[model samples]
Target: MTELQLTLEEKIGQMLICGFDGLTPNDHIQQLIEKHHIGGVIYFSRNYANVKQIADLSYELQQMNAASSQVPLFVSIDQEGGMVARIDNDEVTLVPGNMSIGASRDDELAYEAAVICAKELRQMGINVNFAPSLDINNNPKNPVIGVRSYGENADLVSELGIATIEGYQSSDLAATAKHFPGHGDTAVDSHYGLASVPHNQARLMKLELAPFIRAIQAGVDMIMTAHVMFPAFEPEQIPATLSRRVLHDLLRVQLAYEGIIITDCLEMHAISKEFGVAEGAVKAVEGGADIVLVSHTLQEQVAAIEALIGAVRSGRIQEEQIDVSVKRILALKHKRHVGEYEQLTGSVAEQFGTAERKDLIRQLTEKSITLVKDEQQLPLNLSEPTLVIWPEVRHHTQVDEPIVQAYTLGPALAELGANVKEFRIATHPTEEDIQSAIQLAAQYKQVVVVTYNAVSELHEGQVEIVRQIAARNDVALVVASTRNPYDLNQFSEVKTYLCCYENRPMTMSALAKVLTGQLKAQGKLPVTLSPEYSFGMAAQ
Candidate 1:
């Protein structure tokens, strides 16, 4: 038996993955598949209405490609759980993020999280999940990857990352280890501009590249390129997404990764601002990336496809190179049993937000809450009234969107047999806002202040609010709902501190329990906060 060969247009299409605007298939995306023969499509939160809608959209996209192309389309999503989940709705179960697993220091929990996520994604007709971010969060100032990373230590990151890869593959969904060669140590966010890593090769091997090697050895299906520039690997200061030396000589030749290599979204400012979208796509292919992701704008996707076709015709990009990439892409599709189009059949409604799955989420969250510092103020008297100060914050990666409303713990606290009063503040609180919160705290017997991502300089206002409230009230407690534990270094006057890692619903529920002594704090610090509070320190 012989496999069918793809035409030049079809082969070029296999190298490009695009994103569209509508929840359902639109005219532009349909044309891209029917005429242009695009290899895949990536879904975002904007493309989803509910679980049924997302599943239908995925089925429709596959059917459209089946009508014209020889290969079925690859439907992918960034269902990394926690804050990075794309299919978050009432029907979907939200799991703990990567750093929560790190805090537990349990590799089995990490593997279980991946398995649960894979099952849910497969139920929705999604074949690929871009997850298990292999970056090690060594720098506290890294704006993009905080709780998304496993931990700060290379060995722990390696162990947990490999576990996640195995879990996803076992469940029949292809797993992707993202931002190759590590994006954890960089201070800048690639979404806004180019980020650079100044470490030399030896340093990289010891800290950054360690986990990626483990993932490759574990047989990861795909590896995504980072847009950050590594001066040590490529002297020309080119980003890893466009540098041949880093992708080809290092990853392919040295690391011997036979899996498909995909680029981070070319529309990101790191690539689009430096090189035009079309030109960046061409360079990504030449640099040994099997898939070039143009995740926004139909015009940009078409320009990238046309540019690749022209490059092949002009002998700038060899046809043989294109064939190699298409072959790898086809091989993955066949392995996943998605190479041929077939109508999805089964009752997926039973799998979405099942009681069993939600229990796993609760278990992970309860094991990840770290109580870094506590005086005698913990487990506040249930009979006394307390003021809950909540600060609304925006995700650092999603800077373009409006700020999220304050996530109040008052309701959860009140449910736990306490008299709770809610006081909300803006993401960036004004002087009057801080003063008002301070005045409100004066009337209560105790005050619990919640700060989200206050470790970054951008959230200094939140840190200042904590300082002001702690100065006036003797019974003020600080809850840092962020991955970075260094926020505690700012307010030394605060008697009690808790690190919730993330502000997900499960984590919030777990925090409420811990405050009331219903659940014991067993999670340790995954990373060192300061000299006094080192790794693995937790309140007994």
Candidate 2:
């Protein structure tokens, strides 16, 4: 079906990609598809259970949409791997994230990982993957997007980002390079509130925008807008999701990107709490976003479509403008073969999570384990009693799920027959928790302190606890960051440090191997840990 054939309501519906409750297709989702004619659906951990279930659900959603809308639904997921994967199960290949790939200093690994992830996603009927985050994580204080981004260097990020983009496209999956205009320099999380980048056009172009420009030139399938505000681009304090100057004037006109432009979910506090999602959706479309994502609410999804239709009818946004977006959406769907109604048959599930794939993923993880520094503590004696100070599992950001945080280094070490005694502390340790942890460390011959993105600004308790524990002269101490490597900057006095860049089971297993001397720490630092530690600094 062409753009002209779609009604104004349908056109507006195509601009929205909504999320609803339940693992299966519920009434709200069906209404969005059959009745409202939405173009696509976004999958989250709430919508996923396991490999086979999600695969079947994707197929069912496409089949249902095909019967009503004529345009097949874009089954989309944020399977960027590492910390942000939506469908993480034992039956699927758990690819390491972009930063891990960057640490390996091999663009081929980035390509290979993306190819494996894309092939697995395709088997599950997921045509579009919001991946290859090109944001440069230059600021260590960034709460979100720490390990999701490739690295601090523009050239490295550009090389790896393009490599990943090509990998996904080669497997016929629509790859999206996300959080455009950059979201890597902020201290705030957009899920909680608005964040802004205060750089001028020259600095942004040199640092933040470099990877995106390379991605556009590489012919990336889509670009996802950031909710971050840039005072340099738009004078108003609104985020890029609602700024015409940022999205249309800068990205579309100045950059000349013709691919699909998707907004980061309007339901996020950055947009929803400030401007309201329904109004934000209309403004997103006006700002040159082809797809206005509302990831978590049914009422907001319906209201957004209604508001967009009202905007067109009232001439606040012209019908021709809506047509332009619809045309691009249709063109990309046809180009990617997502518009075709087809069902995957013959147990594609068997191809996923194979021993060979697991081996490859394990190798990548082992290669990414970075030994930042070591003070004659190359490998711990498993014969001696070791105390593992583990943080109580908590959401790192609103984007994180508890399931993703379930894996830990303590269990992985115990499984290896290490004499490990685990002590769980709060994510942000209390004064009593810190004192208790300190006394517990005194009882052991060796101590391993694991941190989860404990930047000094927010997680001062975790930082202080590690600092005081490392000061003990009687016990051997080794500090490791299981999430972001930036924790090293908080406790520079610690003589030994390592970073795994994620808390995934694979990463935990790899860190265990490194500690036991089963594998060497061969990864380089993807980002600058501090003034004392530069990019590519690693100790063998």
Candidate 3:
């Protein structure tokens, strides 16, 4: 151990990982490693340029730490495909979300997805995969967990979670089952601010905790604490990150999870709004969080170490506690054998994201298309100019876009026929836009309303518009439920509702094949919608 390692302050440094701003920030990160001895780094889109660049970066980062001390650093990232990937986007194959995979209901496919995810991550020197989102999306109004979750059902989620975990670890990457004690029922996002849950032990044990329990039973190597506050469980002042009741009493003791427990980012609004990163880091370790995440503070990374060191010396915190986390972390590193990347074996990228597994996404999209409520004209008159209502893919400037290819919906639609004219309906349809679609319906023999929800937002008016147009005598509705499938109430009139679950490359192709009569739609809805439709309802 280096001089820094001699102090509890320095070991705590190994607990607070951070994200940086380039593919080649390895040298600056190395300087920090030598200075503070941080536990690890959480990679985002910014730190990566391509596969080769990231692999080289990971090598240099590991080399610097080896030069300083033999204590291994946790190299981690969110490789949860669909929308959650953070490496070299263009260089990496963009996989669909968990719900899409769950829609297929194929365990092998889920396993393969993880295998590919792990292969790429492993090739680039990532040892910890902060993924296999075990959240049971029991709430339809849940904004963040909609597409990210496997489905609404607990058993389904547990099954897929196990498969995903297995896939990730198959290549020797440490799999972390996240947002512990269930982030499923909460309505708000922990990213923007704190979210609360008020359920008791009975309800939590029955529903919300199912996937988490199952995931833990499935051999999850790590568990990440949710930033959300569940006041009912422990009414005092602790969020899950700071709550010893949840982390120690429940997850550690009750669930019997002996591995490391990593807290979600301490820099998130939930943690930052109250405690500084240093204070949060100190409390989190006391709360039994083996690894406290400070993903955005490279400069302030040393502060947490300094605080913990002071606290340990003052008897406010103990050195043994720090050693506990350090031991668990070292075990994780040893399991990874951090310096032995070259010796790590099993599946590689070629085994992952194959043409066959890629085909499953298309197959699931076609199967998951839920035809909610449709008028008598089942297959449509087939002569109308189909109105394609696509919610604009809003561009967020805060996070860098992965170099992955720009996504589009044209080629799939074009396969059906050249005559299928497409119109861009604002996802949240406007009254005037409805009138425009209505007017176009008059000129065309059939009016097909194709709809898509961009993110968690419910394009409220579009469904009402579909309901109105579908009531027409000559018109037929073809509602394509793209993205999150929750907004099914928007199209009561459409004869066919398709839950494509996502807008990935294969999903579009599957939809195109189904619409053009190349393949019959076979997917059933994976989760329960409103009172309007039952769960697993798929069209013929």
TM-score versus the correct structure, for each prediction: 0.96, 0.96, 0.88
lDDT-best of 1 and 2: 2
Flag the better candidate by lDDT, 2 or 3. Answer: 2
Among all windows of ten consecutive residues in candidate 3, which has the lowest summed lDDT? 397-406
* Residue-level lDDT tens digits of model 2 in 114-232: 88888888888889999989999988878789899889999999998998999999988999998999999998889889999999999999999999999999999899999999999
Cα-based lDDT for every prediction: 0.83, 0.87, 0.71
Instruction: Show model 2 residue runs off by greater than 4 Å.
Output: 340-349, 404-407, 415-417, 430-432, 456-458
- TM-score of candidate 1 against the unseen true structure: 0.96
lDDT of 3: 0.71
How many backbone clashes are present in model 2? 0
True-vs-predicted CA distance for residue 411, candidate 3, Å:
1.5
> How far off is residue 183 in model 3, in Å?
0.8
Tens digits of per-residue lDDT for model 3, 1-540: 432355654676777677776778655576668887787888887777666667777877877777776777778998777656675244465566778777777777678767867776787788898988888787787766777788888888889899999888878899999888888788877766778888888888887788888877877889999987777677876689988888898888998888889988887777788777788878888888888787766655667667778888889887777787777777777777766764223443453345665565445345544455544445533354555544443444222132223343445565556356655565555678777766766665555455555223446656666676767766555666666786665444355666777656666667666665667666656778776676676644
Q: Model 1 clash pairs?
A: none
Which consecutive 10 residues in model 1 have the weakest lDDT in total?
399-408
Score residue 255 of candidate 1 by CA lDDT.
Answer: 95
